[model samples]
Target: MSETNRQWLLAKRPDGRPTEDCFEMVEREVPDPGPREVLVRTRYMSVDPYMRGRMRDAESYAEPWDVGEAMRAGVVGEVVESNSPRWEAGDVVNGNLRWADYAVADEDQLVPVDPDRAPISTALGVLGMPGRTAYFGLLDVGRPKPGDTVVVSGAAGAVGSVVGQIAKHAGCRVVGIAGADEKVHWLTGELGFDEAINYRETESVRGALAEACPDGIDVYYDNVGGPITDAAFAHLAVRARVVVCGQISLYNAEERPTGPRKLGELITKRARVEGVLVRDYVERYEEANERLAHWVADGVVQYRETVTEGLENAPDAFLGLFDGVNIGKQVVQVSDPEN
Candidate 1:
C-alpha cells in the first residue's frame, strides 16, 4: 500500500464562475480499509453540471461540498483492498469516491462493475446516473407518445443526448439544441435526431424551434435551461410535458435566472413542467443500467466522452462544462489502474 494519496479539496466557495483558486491539491496518508469497507484506487472521475450546485452553500436537492473537504464526484475504480465479502481485490467498482487517488467505500455504497459488458467508465456516464436520468425523466416525467415531437436542450451532453435518442426510439420526432454546429451535426446525422439547431450560431432559438417543430413541441427534456427553455416553452403544444433534468445555464449564475418570462403560456397550453432528480429513481438503477447497456450493445444508442488526462486538470475539466467545452460526458483519467 502507498503511504500517501493525493486529492483535490474545495479551498473556498466560488463567488461566481470557479477559478483555480477554488481548489487546492493536497497529499495525505492512504487509510486502511475497515470491517465491511474497501479501499478503491480511482481510475476515472466524472465532472458534471450538477457538481456546480454542490460547490455552493445554498440549499439544493443535494448538500453542498464542504470547504476544506475532498471535492466529491462519481468515480470508477479498482478495489485494492477489501474487507467486504461482496467485493474482492482487483474488482472494478463505481461510487461517490470524490476527487482523490484512493477512497474508502462502505459496503452499502460500492457497486461492482463488469468490464466485459461495457467500458467500466460507462458506469460514470451513459450506463450510470446520466442514462437513468434520461430514462426516468423522459419516460416517467416527459411521457413522450408515439408521433409526438420531443425537444432537448444541451442535446450533445450525456443526459440530453440519451434523452433525444430514447425519444426517437419511442417513435417520436426528436429535435435537439446544442452549443456548436459540430454537435448539431452529430445529433441529427449520427444520433437519428429529426432536427438539430446550433444555439450558438442561431440568432433566435424560438424561431429555430418554430421552424423545426411545425407541429409544436409535445415533450421538452431540458438540460441547459435559460432562454432556450423559455423558447421551448413558447413552442409547446396543448398538454405538453416539460422535464427539467438540469439547469446548467443557471448553475453558474450568481443570482437567480430571469429568462423564463412566459410561464403564463404553460397555463394557456395546459402543459406540465416537472423537475427531476436522478437520485429519486435509485431503486430502478439496475433496470435502467441493463436497458441502457442493451441499447449500447445493439447500436441503438451512441455516446461520446471528452476525457482530460491527469487529476490535476480536474478543475479545468469541471469548469469546461459551463462553457460547453465537452461534447458528451466530461471525464478525467486520474491514474491508470494497470500502473
Candidate 2:
C-alpha cells in the first residue's frame, strides 16, 4: 500500500454556485485504524445536490461542513485493514465517508456491500440514499392511488427517476418533468413514464403540465423548487399530496428568491405538502433495501449512472449537477477496487 493518502478539503464556503477554487486537494500520511475502526480504500464516492446545502454555515437536517476539513460523501470501498472484530481486510463496505483515497471509520458506521449481488458503486446510488429518498418520499408522503396522475420534477435524476418508477408500480399515471428533451425521452421511453415534459423547452410549464394531466395532478414529487413547483402547485387535484424532496433550483441562489404565493391554492385544494429527509426513515432502511433489491433483480425497476472518471474531478462532478450534466446518479470513481 502507498504511504500517502490523497484528500479533497473545503478551501472556503461557496458564495453561490461552488467553484473548483472552493476545494483543495492535498496529500497526507495514510491513517491507521484505531480500535473499533477500519481503514477503507475508497473505490467510488457520490456527489449529490444536498452537499451544496452543507457548504453553508447554517442549520439544517445535517451539520455544515467546516472550511479546511476533508470533504465527505457517500463512499464505497474495500477494507484495507481493520482493528474491529466485525470487519476484516478485503471486506467490501459502504458508508458516509470522506472524499479521500483512504479513510478510517468506526465499525458501526460501515455497512457491508455484496459484490456478487450488485456493483459496489450502487451502494451509493440506486440501492443507497437516493433510492431510499425516492421510496419513502413518494410512497409514504405522496401516497398516490391507482390511476392517479403523479408528476416528478428533476425526473431524470437518481431520486426522481426512482420516484417515477415506484409510482408506476403502484399503478399511477406517471408524468415526469425534466430539463432536456433527451431526459424527457429517457424517462418516458425507458422508464415507462406515461408522459414527460421538457421544462426548459416548453414555453409554458403550467400549460404543458395541464395538458399532460387532463384529470389534474394528484401527486407531485418535487425535486426542483421554483417556477416548476409553482406550475405544479397550480394544477393540484383536490386533496393532492406534494412531496418536497429537494429544491435544487434554489440551492445556488445568492438569496432565496420569492415567487408566486400559492399557499392559498393548497388551502383551496385541501392539499398536503410535506418535506422529507431520508434520515427520518432510518429505522426502516433494511425493509426498503430488501424491496429495492428485489425490484432491481426482478427487472421491475431500472437505473442509470453518470460517472466521472477520477477522484481529482470530484468537485467538477458536483458542479455539473446544477448544469443537468448527469442523467441519473452522479458519482466519482476514486480507484479500481482491486488496484
Candidate 3:
C-alpha cells in the first residue's frame, strides 16, 4: 500500500459558476483506522450538481463545504484495513467519503457492495443515489397515473433519465427535454420516451411542448429550472403534479433568480409543486435499491456514465456538470480495486 494519500479541498468559495481554481490538492500520510473504523481506497467519486450548492458558505439541504477542508462525495471503494468486526481487508463498500484515494469511515457509515450483483462502479451511479432519487421522486411525489403525459427536463441526465424511464414504466406518455440532439435520440429512441425536444435547437421550448403535449403535461419532473421550467408551467394540465428534483440551471447563480411568477397559472390549473431530497427517503432506500436493480437486470431501465479519469481531474469533471457535458451520471475514476 502507498504511504501517502492525496485529497482535494475547497480552495475558495465560488461567486458564480465554479472553476478548477476553487480546488486545492494536498498529500497526507494514509492514516490507520481507529476503533470501529475502516480504511478504504476510493475507486469512483461522483460529481453532482448539488455539490455546487455546497461550495457556498450559506446553509442549504446539505451542509456547506468549508474552504481548505477535505470535501466529501459519494465513493465506491475497497477496504484496505479495518478496525471493525463487520468489515475486513479487500471488502468493497460505498459511502459519502473523502474526495481522495483514501479515506477512513466508521463501518456503519458504509454499505457493503456486492460486485457480483453489478459492477462496483454502479454503487456510485445507477444503483446508488441518482437511481433512488428518481424512483421515489417520481413515484411518490409526481404520482403519475397511466396514460398521463409526463415531461422531464434535463431528461438525459442520471436522475432525469431514470425519472423518465420510471414514468414510462407507470404507463405514462413520456416526453424528454434535453440540450443536445444525441441526447434527444437516446431519450426517444433507446429509453422509450414518447417524444423528445432538443431545447438548444428549438426556437421556443414552450411552443414545442404545446405541440407535443396536446392534452397538456400531467406530470412535470423538473431537473433544470429556468426557461424550460417556465415553459413547462405554461402547459400544465389540470391537477398536474410538478416534482422539483433539481434546479441545475440555477445552482451556480451568484444572486437569487427573479423570473416571471407562474403561481397564478398554477392556481387556475390546480397544479401541485413539491421539492424532493433523496436523503428524506433513507428509510426506504432498500426498497428502491431492490427494484432499481431488478429493472436494470431486466432491461426495463438503462443508464449511461461520463467518467473522468484520475483524482487530480475531479474539479474538471465537476465543472462539466453545469455545461451539460455529460449525458448521464458523471463520475471521477480515482483508482482500481486491489491497487
Candidate 4:
C-alpha cells in the first residue's frame, strides 16, 4: 500500500440532482490506525439513492456530508494493518468505509466477511443493509401472512426486489411495480412475482393495482413513494400494513412533490402505515443474514448488480440511480482482487 491514496471529496452541495462537479478527487496520505482501529483498503464501494439526501445541508436522520470531506458509503475491504487484537492483516471486513480507497475503522465498526457462502460483496447488498431492509421492513413491519396480497414499488431495485421475493416465499400473492417493461417481465416471469406493472407506461397506477390485486392489497412495501404510494394507499384492505422503506421519487426533487390525498382511506380501512430504518434491527443482523444466505443458497432468492468498472466512473454510476439507468444494486468496482 502506498503512503498516499486517491479519494473523492464532496466539493459543493448539490442544488438538485448531483453532478460530477459536486465531487472532487484528490490524493491524500493513508491515515494511521489508532488504538482499537484497523486500516482498510477498500475494494468495492456502494452508490445508493439514500446518499442523495446526505448531499443536502438540510437535517435528516443522518448528518449531511461536510464540504471538502470524503463522501461516505457502506464499503467492503481488506485489513492491511491492525492495532486491535480482534482483527489482523488479510481479514476481509465490511463497514461504513465511505467513498475512499482506504479508511481507518474502529474495532466495533467493522464486521468480518466470509467468502465461502457467497461473494464478499454480498455483505453490502443481498446479505447486508438492503437485504435486512427488505426482510424486517416487510415481515416485521408489514406483518404479511400466508395468502396475503403484497405489493412492492421499485420492485426491480435492490431492496424492493428482495422484498417482493421474500413476500412470495412467505406465501403471499406478490405484485411488483418498476419503471420499464423489461424490469416488469423480470419481476413477474423470473422472480415469480404474481404480477408486475410498468408504472412509467401505465396510465393509472390505481387501476393497475386494482387489476393485479383483485382481492385488495393486504400489505404495501413502498420503496419509491410519490403518486405510486397514493395509488397503493387507495386500495388498502381492512387492517392492512404499509411499510415506508424509501421515497426515491422525491430524492432529486427541488421541492417536495404533492402526493395523493388518501389519509381518509387509512381510517376507513383501519390500516397502518409505518416507516422503517434497518439500523433498528442491528441486534438481529446475524439472524437476518443467516436466513438471507439460506434463501440465496437454496435458489429461493436471486439478485443483480449494475456494476461500474472503474473508480473514476463512480460519479456517473451514482447519478444513474436517479435516471433509472441501474437495473439493481449499483456498485463500483474500484479494483478487482485478481487484477
Instruction: Give the candidates in order of lDDT, highest first.
Output: 2, 3, 1, 4
Over 4 Å off, model 2: none
- Tens-digit lDDT string for candidate 3 (141-208): 99999999999999999999999999999999999999999999999988999999999999999999
Give per-candidate clash totals: 0, 0, 0, 0
**All candidates: TM-score:** 0.98, 0.98, 0.98, 0.97
Q: For model 4, what is the alpha-carbon lDDT of residue 3?
A: 74
Candidate 2 colliding pairs, count: 0
Better of 1 and 4 by TM-score: 1
lDDT score, residue 292, model 2? 94
lDDT of every model, 2 decimals? 0.91, 0.93, 0.93, 0.90
Weakest 10 consecutive residues of candidate 1 by summed lDDT:
251-260
Model 4 lDDT per residue over 85-145, tens place:
9999989899997687789999999999997889888788998899999999998999999
lDDT of 4: 0.90
As a whole number from 0 to 100, the lDDT of residue 252 in candidate 2 is 90
Write one digit per residue (lDDT tens) for candidate 2, span 117-208. Answer: 78888898889999999999988988889999999999999999999999999999999999998898999988999999998889999999
Residue 187's C-alpha lDDT in candidate 1?
Answer: 98
RMSD of 1: 1.1
lDDT of 1 by residue, 263-300 (tens): 89999899998999888888888889999999999999
Q: Which stretches of candidate 1 lie over 4 Å from their true place?
A: 258-260
